[model samples]
Each structure stands twice: as structure tokens, then as C-alpha cells.
Target chain A: MSHRARSPSTALRPTRRALLAGLGAGAASAFGLARLARADAPPPSGTAVLLCFFPGGWDQLLLLDPRDPSRFTASEAARTRIDPRYDELVGLGYRPELVRPRAAPAMVLGPLAERPGAAVQLTDFAGRMAVVRGVDMRSVSHEVATRYFLTTEFPRGSLAQGSSVSTTLTALARPARPVAHLSLGVESYNDRHPSRWSALRVTSADDLLATLCPAGAVDPVLADALDAYAREARADVYNRRGLVDRLQGARAVARGLDRDDVSRPFRALVDDGPENDALRARFGISRGDFDGPRARAAMAALALTSGLSQVVIASVAPAMDTHFVGNAGHARLLGEGLDAFVALLDALRTTAHPEGGSHLDHTTVLAFSEFARTPLYNTYGGRDHHSAGSCLLLGRGVRGGVVAGATSDVGMVAVPWDLTRGGASPSGTVLTPAHVAATVAAAAGLDPTAFDAPPISQVLV
Target chain B: MGRAPRRLDAGQLRASLLHATGATWTGDRRVRTNNDPSGYALRPATDLVRHYASALGEPDYGATTEPDLDPGPGFLRRAQSAAQGACRDGLRRDREVPAGARRLLRAVSDGDTYARAPEAVRANIVALGRTFWIRNLSPDGPEVEALLGVFRAVTEREGALPADGWFAVCVALATDPQFLLY
Candidate 1:
């Protein structure tokens, strides 16, 4: 019998299109079109970078290898067995020219020695880098930690924990831009962090139209009836609730509706554009597969280049929380997704901005998450969440081919760094999520201290 | 045509579960299994739930399996039946809660917590009760909530409620999204 013969009907039929359509107009309206409305130019040192978040805790040990077997614990022996090519990735710089091959050749950073099935490697990347370990977050709960990481505020009784570092930075850096903060996929957390940053969400091709188009006058009769209803509703709520900010934001969104140039949908934006074919081929995406993360990233990158927004956050789908399967699943999803993400960056780096400049030198890409996985494998062969995780910072200004922190043999030990005032390792000084946020803020030219946290001096230029 | 079951290759299954539950495997290890050494079995969802809950320090909120409630034969059918039964029970719980409590529950249960909940809780419950639904449903699967985009919604909504009854709801939702979804 054929494979489809054994599967349930629902399994064979695609469920994504219906899923996208079912999403509410409000949700769909979040992503706007790519337009270049010249506003006050960004600061002289303006930088635009992509921040990709892996929602679950990632296994840093697997991605950044430790070289010495003596450093390995009994549990981390499996990691020592990683393909030496990844260890080589430690020293490999960006190879923008390579096309057919998915990733650049791995550059081994340190010496390697084998013990049993495991092999240990070494690197100088960790030395110049700063890894502040053992930072105690107020809540071990995933939701709380997530909120803490993004907003630098402890999860409180209310859901709106605080504005995220990105939103805050964008707000402070470029207050004049319409879509200062743009989210390409699903918004993270429950708090209106995206909304707070005046972030416009664009998850699909359709959303692109709803957000950017100028509102055409509706049928006079229907418009009159709807206007009357809206007037009453607005008076009832706005007058009583004192929600001026919401009303203002709503008005701004409304102004974009039906606007001629802005209304042109993403399809038109990409249909014959220079990057269109390249995007489709590179991401392995087709018109039919337009809602997935790869498609979302491509769309968002196109928007960035078009100057529709200053900051864009894209959420890739197919969760990366690999519990039962160890290296292979993560290698394929996280590793490959990351590889594709880098590929997108490379594409962006090469693509000139609509205004006749390259976005590569101006954009900085930071991939991060809430935490890291434990050193040991479970009975089911999975890893658990640990507080200290690794983040990949890649851009023109960012120091490349450098491992910013240290991990011990079993991957449990976080080596110390005393460079920053509070930058310490798991064994020594404690670092807080706020510190990382501060680093990002400083890089964006926002005041880190505004959020009551100092920027991680070492990671910044 | 019947497609081959996406059999969890030992490595893939390990990776999927780890990413799904945020659990890690460490310590002196040998790949021991009840089945053959090379051939590993995918643990039942219930077993996976239990392991995950324990790791997350959550209460064991598994489905109540009475001999009387057995629907028999197919696992998916049985699970569906259990879910319906759970929803009915959740409705009973919802009825006893106060409107204020329900409102608070709704705030906490918004988004992922609300989606993963039994239909009864999503419909009938409010603030704290909605939060309870999340806790009862997916205590070990917080990341699932994140993936669903509900985690942030609940957080954003939390601010609209009063403080006295709010923190408990937040904690409940945090633990709930994890426990209920898996």
C-alpha cells in the first residue's frame, strides 16, 4: 500500500491556507506594505539588523564546541562527538560569494583530541568573548523568563510586563517613522510590546495590502451607516475609558488604509522585483507555500529593503523545541533554519536599499532566545532548559567568528568573564537578562540605562 | 495511499521532544531502551507528559482514566473522548467560579492558554478560571504556548486586571500553557 493509504485524510490535506484565512482581520492587518515615505533620516550611525528569536531554550554546547576532553563531563561526552566541521564554523567568517553550497566551509578554532566515541576541540573565540553566567532571573517559568528576556522586566501580575528592548530602542532611536517596529510573523509574549513600539505586523501577502493601502471611500450608504456606528462606539469607549493612545494608533493605522502607493500588496511588490526570483529559489518557497517562516522572512526582507520599516522581527514556524530527538532534529531545524536565516542576511547584505545604498553595512542580525539546554541527555534523549544560553551576533559592526562565552566539558559549566562590570560566568559573577537587552539597546544607539540596565560593554563597539 | 508513519528515528524523536518540552538529557549515559538498543520507541503522549511535568515541577494533571470511561480500540478516538469528558468536567468547575474570578481567569487564559484549554473553560471561564484551564491542560508545554503566539497575548492582557487576584493567574497560565498543550 502507498504511504498515503495508511494516513488519516486530515494528515494528507494541507491545513495552512485555511489557518491563514481564519486569522482575524485585526491579526492580518498587522503587516503593512513596503513603502519609502521619506521621514527624518536615521542618526548618522543608524544601524538596522534582524533579531531572530528561538522561543525555546537552545543547546549552546552543540552549536559552540569546547575542545578539551578534560573539560568534558561524563554527560557531555555525546557533544564531543559533534562533526568537527561545526567546530571549524567557530573561526569561519562570512563567505558572501558562495551560492550553491548552503553553508560556508567550517573553520576549526582549536585542536581536537578523541576519547572513545567523543572528540574534544579548542578555540580562542571564547577568550575575547564575554559570557556572563549563573544570572538568577526572578522566575524560572518559561513565560516569565521570556518576558524578562525581551522586556527586561520581571513578569508581574499584569500581562504588559514592559516594552521590549527592541521596541524601546526603536522608539528612542526613530520616533518619526510610521512602522518603527515591524513584526513579520506571529508576535511573541502576551504583552503589547509590539504595539507599544508602534510595530506593524505583516505575516502574509494579504496583510501587506490591508495595512499600506489608502482607504477608498466606501459605498456612500454603507459608509454612512458604518460611520454612525463607529462614532457611537468610539464615543462610548474613548470618552469613558481615556484610551487616547489606542485611538491615535488606530487613527494612524486607518490613515494608511486605501492610500494608493501604500495599498499595493506584497504580491505586486515582489512579482517582478529584482529579488523576487532569487528569494523564491533561495528559500525554496512557492506562491502556494507563502505562509511559512521562509516565506515570511523573504517577505520581511523585501519590506526592509523597500524602507517600509526600520526594525523587523520575523518568527519562523515549525517549533525548534526538540526533546526526544537530539542532534539530528536540532541540526536540521535550528542549524538549517539558522543557515537559511544567514542566507537571508547575505541576500539582504547584497541587495541595495530602494534609496540606493546597501542595507548590509547598516543592518545587524542578532539571533537569541530565553535560555539554553542542560548538559545531560534525558532518559528520552532530550535536553532540559538551563538559564545560560548562547546568542549569535552577526553584522558589519559585530565582531565575527568569535564565541562570546565559555562552556565546560559537560556543557553545564559557564566560564567566567570579568570584562563588563557585572559580566561573569556560571561559576563566578552573575549576569541578568537586562544586561543582554542593554547591549542590544546600546548597539542601536538607545540609552541602555533608560531601562535601568547597563549595556554589555564588551559586545558593543 | 497510506503514508508510512513519520516514525521517530531515535535522533529525530529525541530532537523533537527536546525542542517541544525544553527538556535536556545529560549525565553518564548509555542509550538503554525497553526495546532494542538501536530501535527506540516513541513514548506514549501520556508518558511524555508525565516526564515533562515532573521536570517542570508541575502537578500531575493527566486525564482521569476510569474503566467506566474507556471508549476502546483506537488511541486517537479514546483521546478525543477523554478530551470531551475533560471539557464536561471543566464546565462543572467553571459554573462554581465567581464572575470576578472568571474575568480574572479570562485575562490569564487569553491566547495560548485559552486555545489549549478544554472548550468548557475557553467558553465559560473568566480570569482565574481561564488560567486554571491552562494549568490543567498543558503544564509541561510552555513553549507550545509561545509557538502558538498566545503567551504574549495573555501577558498583554494581564495588565488590564486588578492586582490582588492577578499574580496567581499569571503563574497559573505560565505553568498551565506548558502542562496543557503537550
Candidate 2:
């Protein structure tokens, strides 16, 4: 409830002994950690957060939020007589003739409607997923919408931005991990979290490799030269305690890295070979594009399993600013990307934990976009940006198979809907980006009240 | 004349070696891409030292932001991943890359003193010190005298590979905070 930032420094850094104890009374050797002796580990219910972003805006009409098609059919005029907005869609590009609404039980599914095979892998785990269609994103501009969606801070001021959901969740995770937040080609914002907890970014496995490995060492004789000169140089600036401390701290980390035992695992992860073929397969990296969502998924699994990192930020597909290609382009990209995303979910599900259950059972996923597309097609045959956006949340502690919120048939504006129940006929509360954000924050062990919206408890298990 | 910073990253450390000794990499094996976002051409070690840029195994996820991850703005600000003593023996005591080492010694030494051991030692010290720090050097300074003593002692101990001792001496100068920071 307080605006104060969380600090774990006062808490003893997780000791190997405590980790073993918390591994629970029965199974301490979940991932063969009986000998590893890692400490201060989270309980079995502890969650990992995966923030997957696809750029530009998504077309909810053809994706998660589809309009009901039963209103039309036998008498097209009769359809809108009951709901006049359906008749006006003709002037817009809502081609009743071309649009085919497939029957998905109890939920408005679009990607599957147009094409039966679209994102079919998702069908198996649809029970674990929840989609909220009517989100009044407030801004239709891509930059503003994107920034607002991630950081619940309003777009009124530029510098008013705070730590993004990814950064916040990353900082909230176990602090003892060697690499806490791993950003694989993700653009994120952080405002005043602990210095060390700042994100460690790498674009690809190669970047990860480069970061961990040193160029060859300087000559031994030259090393001594550097050593002697450094010691003497210290006295000249010894009075500047701040500078001296930074230098010493930096040196201490470097020293720890130099040890062969300490550095070997990092180096091993860098160089890819046959051993990683299965991982490459798991994330659906067939051709092995390490910058794709597949790569992020592959590397994220490694980071979590290796004890190298906690929160992983990544993207599923890019080039979403589809002013040129329209729904055809959007559908093509989303279909393929969703397949990769499903593969990632499967991989996460397969990853074994030291405690009972798969990694997905302990992981939470947020798949989002800035906003949705205009219900009507534009002159260029593509959809313009709209304020109504759809967001998806899945994984541990999420109440799945639920759809929240609705949109008007005419302009596709997010309509008011009931969020809470008991006294009122309808719990009509328009879900904003803040409520969505807070729901995610609460799931990740953070105080949601720090942001504008309270947690939408209905979605939480 | 003074400290450049608390530490210089590995790339700067390598550049200091090449610059201080006036060593020319004559092989001309160009390591950098024609349009590498990072201005500096990469050596094998330099490649390892540079922050992630067009690294192998990376995907082409962007139609915009070529080379990925908004690399241009932060090209100059790659943080220090300096793994302490991890790279202490980067050049390796065993590998014999002699021609480069020989050329370095000759370039730093006054003419004719390079081949004859002990003759060009002091002039070489002043020359290397001047370039390594990117400033003029006074032969009278205690740091210079102390560096000269280090070279002589190392040269004696390295009887088989006496040139390495000189190379080691240069390493000391190059890794100095003044040499690293600026």
C-alpha cells in the first residue's frame, strides 16, 4: 500500500542452507539441487514472470475479441434491426461475405474463426488462459499506448514514466540470483531500483557469450605492469572515497568472473552445439533465429534453470506497425507468432522444477500490445489504430477460460462491463490499463497499489 | 598527467597495447563489418571484448533498428563486464606471437638499441609511458624509474623469452588507470 520501493538488503542474502530447507520437507532434489546448496530460494508457489510483447497494434476483431456473427445471416437487414450498428458495418470494411466466424465454445475467438488451424496448439491449454477484450487504452498513438500499457503511469508527462511491469517483477524476484533480469532485445524502463538489480541485457546468445567471456588476457609481464601502476595510481585519488569504492566493487566482480570454476558455466552456455539442439527445438527455433521470440523463449528457459537470471523480457514477433499490409498481414504474423508462443508455453510446461509441478505451474505470462485496430478497414486496406485493446494472461494462479469486458459493434470502442458482483445487477467497471497492470503486478509478488489501478481479483486464483 | 577513470574496459586495454608500443597489425585481416555500428574495427580479442553488436545466432527481428536492440545510441556506453582477473593472462604466457612483440619493442626503443638487450631500455620506457598515458612523459618521475626497474627484473627472469618481459612491462603501463581511463 505504501509508495516505498522494496529493498531486500536487510534480509540475509539467501543462504544455501535456507534454500534446501525451503525446497520443502519432501523434495529437495527437484532439479538435482541436493548437492548444489543454493540458499534463500522462493517457496514452491513462487512465480516467474514472462512479458511477451508484439509491436504495433493488434486487430482484436481478427484475434482475441471477435464480434458475434449470429446476428446476420438469413436476413441481413433483420440482424441490424435488432442491433442497428451491424447494418452500418457495411459502409466500413466489415465484409459479412468474407468474414467467417467459427464456433468456439463460450469465448469470442478470432484467429481460429477465419482459419480453423490458426494457433491450434493453444486449444489444448486454453483452459489455463484468460482474455479481457474491452480495455480502454486511453491513447491510440503507438508510442504513448506502448509506454502506458507497460508502465501504468499516465501518458500526460514524458518523464513521469516509472519502472515497467517487466522491470518491477524482475526486481521483485529472488535477489540472490547471479543474473536477475535478462532483457533479450527488449526495450524497458526502470526508475530508481537498486543499482545491481538493474536489468542485464543481451540481444542474442552470442551477446550473452560476449558478455561472459573476456578477450584474451593481457601479457603476464604486462599484467604486472598494470597491477603495479594501478596500486600507485590509487593514492593520488584515495581521497575520493566514492570513486575508490566503485573501482574496488567493479574489480571485485571482475575478480570473481576470472576464476575458471566460476566462469566456466557461463562460457559453456555461450557456445552452442548439438547439446542445445533440443532447446532450439523446444522454442521452435527451426532455422535458429536467436533474435526471434523463439530465441527469447529458449534463452529464458536457460536463464531460469541455470540460476543465472529470474525475470526474462522478450518479444514474440515484430513489424506490427502494419499501415501497409492490413488484416492479411496482421493475421499472417499473429498466426505464426502465436504458434511460436504456444511452443514457448509447451517448453515452459516441460521444464522440471525441484519442487513438484512443471516450470509453467510456477511461471506467469503476459502477452500484450499497445492497442487494437480500427473495426473498419482504412483506405489503404489496412486498419487504423484504435483505443480498445485486448490482453492475455496465463500460467500459475490465473483463473483460466474466462473472458472479461466487451466492445461496441459500431466503432469497436470498449464498452463498460461489470467487474465485481454481489449487490448490483451488473458490476459495470471499465477495465483500464492500470487494472490490467495491477493484476499482473499482484501475481508477481509486488504491491499493486503502487500503481493507479487496484488488482482485478476476479482473474487471480 | 592523472587518472582517466577507476578502470578501463578490455577494449581500451587492447588499444593501449597497440598504441603505446606503436605496434602495427600488418596482416590486414579486417575483422569489422563494413557497416558495423560500433566504430572500432574488431580484433579476435576485441570482438570478444565489445558489447553485443551483430553477434552470431541473433535473429533479424526488426525491419527498423537494424543490427537490433537500439544499438546505436548506447554504442559508446557499454558497461564494464570486466571479469576481474579472468583476463589477467589474456595474451597467454605460452603462445608465441613473436613478430608483433618484436616490432613493438623496436618501435618503443631508440634506434639501434632495440636489438641489443639493456641498451634501449630507458628510452623505450619514456616512449611507451608517453603514448600509453596519451601525454608527455618525464624520465625523472619516480613512476617511470619504478617501471624501468620492473622491466629489467622481468627481462632477467624471462631468459628464454626475454622479449615477453618487455611486452609484460608494456602491459603494466597500458593497464594503469591513467592509461585505461582517458
Candidate 3:
């Protein structure tokens, strides 16, 4: 196989027709032309991406990368530095055993996946899900590891060095969405991509409403004057940095938010009217629980279904950085996050897409944490941050029911894995977040080479 | 080579608006919570500014080292939203004072219309131009006429109150790019 490295600017050439079209009457300035020139042709597949970030390091042993409890018992703790201490986990709702779905005999999920309170279980989508284990995160610091995974570029002194994967995919897809990228309770960076592709970051539904809703009632005359004056003033100004045009475009989007009544569906979240009773029941969103994982998942569903955004990065899980008695709640925390992810999957599956099948058929989901916890408990009875991590990729172009990569038996360290053959290999390449990102890019119908890493082709259909 | 123009960040924008208009975008006042020993007597806009800080490209000061000076649509919308509230308060404050003591709507009186008092209305537009953008304009110039055009159009419309023109003028000045950008 051969590949040529190209900058994002020159990777795909803009045809003369595209160039002329992009250079609209209003966008004739050098900066405007340059920005529009970088605009990507829409992806051929019309695939949307949902990047689910599980904040804090999650314990993979309890979920995606569980060890066989019968073999790695406490009695063999000395030989194997790892411990399947599920017995010590308090308030654990399910028995400490591996979940081997009959449909997917090759896949083995941990007991925590079946932990109570989750509306949807991991095993529910067994045939459609794919798990990539033993990813080498390369850093244990929360900030470092998170940015590394998010951008696939290691942070320079905890500072993100590149655009987030959400921004990248949004730039590639360039869907004509009101808010192209919506980020709920997640950090999104756009260092190189156009500012329009930047994440419209909000912590909760109310915050999102505040961002999208028009300002409070003003007299019609005043509103008309403000609108007319703004239009006239903007027309006269030509900002060298294209800020004027961007601002005008932003204003138009704000008007569109009002014109289309985009905030109507989201208002159902805060309003406890009978109209929202069905929505509340659908995502398990309790009254006034507008910022929880379930609520975020519901918002993700609505955002995608309503064509409000092209990519959404939602933190569907709570912080699992349990280094003390907090570990007692580790299973619950991890379970709730996974449950939110499950709910999101269910929501995608049940919701009908504009094209034909369910939204899940066209959406790609990548669920990850900064890293995983240590194999063994610390003195505080909780796990410390571990370098090895795992991720879940499924839906839209992913080869389902596949487990690709493995950690060592003793120390739970990431070992070399054959991307092609799907197991530990002495001479195989070690999986990293870069490879995971590349695979998602590939799954989204983008050239994974743009990420400068090869997609694990074995995981793609 | 000339340096490129950079935008005023959220903090700077908020401060400038406060300094220029003497009113900020106010929201519901903060009340005492169980976690608070002394109830926070913060001004109304304090919480609002913080709430929409990210929307306006204010850096979190920890992870984000510099403000996001992108001037993107999100920032523009939030800024406009904030301006709506602040300009309303500004007009209210202006109306409470006598014409001479007013910060905005200086030359125009409560019942002044361009048809009845065109000179006073044009003078107020000139005053607003100076206050908002530090620009001096002739009363007959296209700039003042443009503002008068807004005023004339508003007051001429049915169901329009005379004060609506001034409120419109207030919003137009405050939200204009000349006032927002440095």
C-alpha cells in the first residue's frame, strides 16, 4: 500500500466550479475565499458521528476488557499482578461473571455491563457492537491522555495541539447544520479548522437553549431597527480577518434558530407538560433532571434527529477517577455511563432516519475514556490511572461482533496485537488512540490517511 | 505590515459595555444558598456574564490560555442576546433621567418624533454616534440619515409608539459592529 502525506488544505482539490460557487458575491474577500476554499465536499455516505466521552479513567476490567474471573482468582494474585476483585465491589447488582452473548460467542463483556439501573444493556446490541481493547494511551495524566485521545496528538504540556476529532469529522462532513458541531459537557478544540466548525459547547439543555434561543422580548420597532441597522452596518464594514462576514453569518443562524423554532423540541426538556411525557419516558429523564447522562443522551438523539448538528460529543458517563472509597461507586459510575451510552444506542436504533433505516444505521458512535484504571486496587481500595485503555466503536460501516487487540495476561499491559488477525501478536503493531481515530474516520467514509494513522481495516466492513 | 485587527474578548466587551453604557446585561439576581455563609450580593449581570462567558469566547483561565477570538456565529448570537438585555436596561435608565443627565438619547425628549422634532432626533443620533463609536457626524450626513431612516421607518409603522424609535436607536447603536469591535 502507498500513501502521500498532504496538508488538510491541499488534501482534496476544490474544482473550478466549487471554487466559483464558494466565492459567492458576499464571500469575495481574500479571507472569505480562503476559508470557503478549505470547505470540504460533503462525505458521500452522509454518515454522522457521535463521539461519547466517558470522563475520568474508566475501569476496563469491569466492562470492555474483563478477565475471566474463574482463572484470575485471588489465589493466583501473586503470579498474575492483575486481580478480578469483583467480589470486593460493594453494591454490585450482578454476579461477577463474563457476559457471552449467544449471538456473539467471540465477544465477552464484563459483569458491570449488566449492572442494574441501565435501561439498555451492552449485550442488547451484541451483534452490532465492536470492542477495541488494549489501546496504549501513553499517558496517565487526565489532561494529557484526554487530549491525546481526543485529537490523536499528544498535548504539548497539557495544552491541546490540534483540532478535536469532532471538529475534524465536522470539517470533513461539512453538513449544512445550524450548529455543525455540538459539544455537551466535553472539551472541544478547533486549532486549525474553520471557526464555523468549532463546537457549540454547552453544559446542559438549559445552556443549550440559552445559546440557541433568541433574546428576551423587545419591542417590534426596536427589533426591526436593530436588525436593519445591523444589516446596513455589516454591509459597509469589510474585516480583513473575515470577522464581519462570520458575524453576519452567525446572526443569520440565530435568526434561523428563531425562524425554524429550533428550540421548540429542546423546550420539551424543561417543560413538564403532558406533551413531553413521552420524551421523558423514552430516555428515562426524570422531572428537572435536565443535565444528567440520560438527559444528555436524549439531547444527543434530538440534536441528531432534528438536523441541528453534524457531530456531537456528549459526556454520557460520570467521572470515574476513583482513587479512594470513591471506588466503591466505581461500578455504579461506570454502569451509569455505559447505561447512558446504551440508551443513546437504543435511541438511535428506535428513531427513524430521514433516509430509510433507523438512525443507528447511518450514525457512527465512538465511546472512550481518557484511560483505564489499574488492574489491581491501590491502598485506598480504588484503582489508579493506568496507561492501557479500551474503546467501543459500532454502527455504520463497522464490522460488528469483533474484538480486535489484547492485553498481557499477568500485568494487564497492552501487548502487540495483530490488527488483521485480531489477537495478540509478537510482531504486530500496538493499538493506540491514533489507530482508533483513524478507524472512526474510515468508518465515517473519510480517508483515514488524513489522520496520519492507518485504520484498523479488520474492524471495518 | 499593518497588524491584523483582533476582537475584544468577553471580559473586555463586558467591561467596555458597562463603562460606555453604565448598564450591563442583567439576569435573575443570585440568592443565598446553603453553601454560602454570606449571601452573594452580586449584581444581576454577574451570573449572566459568567453563564454566557464561553459563548462570548471568554477563556476558562485554566485549560484555555487565551480567549477564543474567533468572532464565530455562536459568539455573535450570544453577544447580540446579551446586548438586547443591556440595551433595554440602558434605555430604561436613560428614560428615568432628564435629557441633559441622560447617557443615551441625549437630545431627544420622551415625545420627540422626527416629524415633530427632526433636529432633536438628528442631534440625538449624532450624540449616539459619538458615545458608541467616538465618531462625529454631520446631521445631514448619510450616517445620521441612516439612523433617522430607522427612526422614521419605525414611527411611521402602525401601532408604533414614539418611544419605540428611541429604543430601536439604542439597540442599533449598542449592537453595531463599530461599538462591539475595538
Candidate with the greatest TM-score versus the true structure: 3
What tier of docking accuracy does candidate 2 attain?
incorrect
lDDT of 2 by residue, A116-169 (tens): 433345656667777777888888876677778777776554332676767676
> What are the chain A TM-scores of the candidates, in order?
0.68, 0.73, 0.84
Error of 3 at A182 (Å): 1.6
DockQ for all candidate structures vs. native = 0.02, 0.12, 0.27
Could you give the interface RMSD of candidate 1 in angstroms? 22.9
Reference-based TM-score of each model: 0.52, 0.64, 0.81
> Against the hidden true structure, what lDDT does model 1 obtain?
0.41
Q: What does the lDDT come to for candidate 2?
A: 0.53
lDDT for B31 in candidate 3 is 37
Candidate 2 per-residue C-alpha lDDT over B1-182 given as tens digits, one digit per residue, 9 for 90 to 100: 35433334334444544444433111111233445432124344433333343331122344222221211111112322222211223323213345345323544432222236443666666766665665566676787677766665444442324444554555556444455444
Is 1 or 3 the stronger prediction by lDDT?
A: 3
| RMSD after Cα superposition, model 3 | 11.3
What is candidate 3's lDDT per residue for B88-156, written digit by digit as tens? 677778778776777766887777887789899999899888887788989998778878887887677
Model 3 chain B lDDT-worst window of ten: B34-43
Model 1, A180-265: lDDT tens per residue?
56665433321243233445554454344434532222222212222232222222222222233333343343433311233322
